[model samples]
Target: MKKLFILFIFLLVCNLQSYSQIIFENGYFINENNQKINCLIENQDWKNNPTGFNYKLDGNQNILAADIKTIKEFGVNGQSKFVRALVKIDRSTTKIETMSREKNPEFNDEKLFLKVLIEGNATLYLYDDGNLRSFFYKNNDSEIKQLVYKMYLVGNYSIAKNNYFREQLFIDFKCETISQKEYENLAYEKKALEKFFIKYNKCNDPNFVSNETKKKKDLFNLTIRPRLNSTSFSTNNSMSDTFDIKFDSNTNVSLGVETEFIFSFNKNKWSIIVEPTYQYYKTEKTKESSVYLGGEVIGKVDYKSIELPIGLRHYFFLNDGFKIFANASFVFDFSSQSKIKFTRNDGSEANSLDIKSGTGFGIGAGCKLKDKYSLEFRYLTGRNLLSNYVTWKSSFATASLILGYSFF
Candidate 1:
């Protein structure tokens, strides 16, 4: 288990460094010279606005990088766009624990790459640094301006929001079709602001086309998984050494069905998974008794259970066809009518113990191909099936080679 965990960490680090190479898409960048060069830009599906970007020229093998200082604008075809701008931004923390007492925003002038969410009569832009998200806008020939919105502490006990952005919107964007109630209810979020901007643009010109790039919505999948598990079990009586026994390891097959829900954010690189699996083990052994004279002990075990594992998975795309992922799972098993029995050398029964269900944990790493097939190496921690017994304890561990085929 320790070795498996170390390997998972090593693979995770390596995959993070290499994932950036798989997503170069057709895009164009405007340099300081005002020259628009068509090239392939690496799209990280950035969670936050980036200060620099990587690109490769046509027929070139070497990758290049450009920063906000050199690039005036860049766009990944129809997917997304960013423009360099000098604007007044608030750097105040919105966290309740460290909020300021001032109601007004503390603004500073900074140069940034603002993401274009809607580009029309009234354009909406977003600047996010993972912790803070600030919106900016510009109309006609006016200079770009930040929307005023802040959260601050009130009386050191309660929080207050300054919704000055709604007032700013009502004054700047005087539209006959937009109502004051809509402005008052507008949220300082990406989707709501983008929708409002689109509505305003459409009202002015019915033929207006929103340049907003909507993210893909395929976020669910189901898979069939089959595995070969190398399982081992051992048990002992803590009060008596004569009843202790160890079973030989066995290789068994298991089948499972998995449901995965991929998150819409972070480039669809993370997901939650639930898998239900069925497995069984049956074995028998004989050994001489330590305490009984001229007698032998024969032990037999029969166990069957359905296991449910719920986990989180993170993927690193090598390309559209291939990706690597790592996951951790908490497992719960259910079993009935499973037992271990011991008999005397004369074929008479001595004792029988009912086996109970247990809980365990697992860690795995794997790669998927073409969104259909996958292979994984998984290790499960030891579980004590005799946990219901006070004096008897058991250890069951498994290492598995799992194969997966996605149906959708």
Candidate 2:
């Protein structure tokens, strides 16, 4: 749960919101520590959770959000009395990126109900089905106090790292009144509501608002990457029996697709991109035969990899739909090695998991064209993604031409 807040920011930046705006009502202050804590009362932010208020308040009635609202009613005594309210809309908002021009955006809509009455120096109210809800004199929002409650209900889903802290957002609601009791209920209601949202929101996702919203905003995205990746396997020769081996480094070249999601912060000049893809890579390595084969040369190195490229790219725009960029890619390699031919009697050549994590850095230059496309040339070098007994240095370099599509 706590981890969700951290992931919210990363996922929120993935897309640029094209159309999304929340409707907000009057804002007010919630007295705390002899000071006023100002916040929005009735605001419509994105509600990611499905189980929340239906965005509608009966016209005859009113809805007060986390902030405050005041209403007046004439009592039988002919004196003007006040009906104050405090409404709590408990819902989780998924990641929300303000409307932008680039990607699809979503909004969360929620509605709540409000009503109230005053009595003595306290306020009394109905909590659904006429259940008694009370607030005493000392319960004023200005005073400090603590009261133990019942079972805590967790109604929110964990924030996904990819969802951004944009999810599970909240605001406070309050109302002032001429009726002391009404004010009392309003005060305590506001306090409880605020506490609920804050305590829960923070208890689960500490980064929800603090660190998730501020991130590199991507206004334009371009990805045109064609990768030639292949995997090969070797078996049945060294062990003098039967086995399988897959190596992509030396013997295969399969055309694979590479996709990229890019984000820009400094007016589209500086950006970061995540290229998550499945690539087929081929490699050629010299294999020495042990006592099994006496001494022999291997034919191919083939393997498949799910490559996640985290890149930092800087772009320079020229006149008329033209741009230049120099970017570095850090590759996280997840690969499987098997399905090729290997020694039959060799113990090392037996079935094995070739899982490895390697980091590769690549620098590339790209041009943004009129067709909303990009062409890039890059040189990548890094530690090998393969793990082997012999000296097969991961340090390798490659020059590639990439084509990309720009989305804005």
Candidate 3:
């Protein structure tokens, strides 16, 4: 039945040019251009016509053709490879189909399996009579043959083509059946996508170099320097030491300690510092113009004052948790006490007192430690006015050392 069916298809193709033509036998006469002809008896011995002839089939009839010509056909139904052609004299298809008939005693029914491709890899599956199965063998012609062999073969005949094909097919659909151009283009598209992804966000790209990583860094800081105090004063300018009344600042020891606070934001560091101090002073001197043993002498005066220092600080980090800093400040002093007393040769005692505020500038440098601590030394110079020169001018300066901490 299949051969007869195939033959019929062939004849239809042979006589297609003649729309009204009929074929007589698998190897009989064919009419071109629908032309009517004289009667020729069927099965008449020695009755062959004058035209060149061969017989093929058309429906239930036979095709008798006068000439044989060649043609080439491409994939039919988009699956099988066909570099050869079917006769087009009649301009019709001679379709080919394969199926296992249960009615045929030799029916060894096999099914086509499926497969799918992903990221350059293959996934295989087995199908049986429109259903899935476990037993499959390899066959270059079909996927079922391939899967079966892969499931049971011990030889090279079980190549993964079935597996490869199974991967190409999926869900009762045959994608591998598409033309070769489309398949190659699909693979090319995936490759391009991979390259694009790797270029944009891949960590391993050779050209992707940056210092913009989030990481902890050792940073420079700023701090206050400790304060030091000393005093020097002279009174009553004289040409000779023999005649003089002189009193000088004494016990001029400043009390000092450094206090600092630091802060950090992003890559910048800032600091605030203050060094407050106090000093105690006492002195007495007499100037002589002697008018014969008549003399007046004064007792020492006690003086004390508090100094307030405030400054702004800045720093830059170098390395190894080290930093350099500079600072500037203003100083103010408020005297708490001052008193003086004097006695005369005529039996008289006198008293005098003086006190006032002083102002100044402070400058310094220091190093930062551990991102939190720092130490520094700085010089402070400022003006002071007290007792209207009875204490002389309060011009004094000091160097100090300090320690500080940060909270950032």
Best by TM-score: 1
TM-score for candidate 2: 0.37
Looking at model 1, residue 255 earns an lDDT score of: 95
Clashes of each: 0, 76, 41
Candidate whose lDDT is highest? 1
Ten residues in sequence with the least summed lDDT for candidate 3: 85-94
Candidate 2, which ten residues in sequence have the lowest lDDT sum? 71-80
Candidate 1, superposed: residue stretches over 4 Å from native:
1-21, 214-217, 302-306, 332-359, 388-392
Count steric clashes of candidate 2. Answer: 76
TM-score of each: 0.85, 0.37, 0.34
TM-score winner, 1 or 2:
1
lDDT at 107 for candidate 1? 88
Residues 1-408, candidate 1, lDDT per residue (tens digit)?
A: 435544765576466656644678999999999999999998777778999999999999799999998999998988889999999998889777788889998988999999999998799999889799899999867889999999888884698899999999999897999998999999999899999999999988999998866556668989999998888888788886556778888888999999999987667888999999998988887777865655678878999989899999988887778888888899999987899898877788877889996899988888899889998878888898887899998888888888999998
lDDT per residue for candidate 2 within 1-408, as digits (tens), equals 212322432243232121122233233332323343333332222211111221223332354333222211111121111222333322222223321222222222322222222222222222221232322121224321112111221224322222111111211112221223332342235345343333344444455332122334445454545543212233332434222223343322223234444442223456667776665655443445453454544434355666676888765544435655666778776776632323323334533334353677655555667637777655455455434523322333344545666555
C-alpha RMSD values across all candidates = 3.6, 19.7, 41.4
Candidate ordering by lDDT (highest first): 1, 3, 2
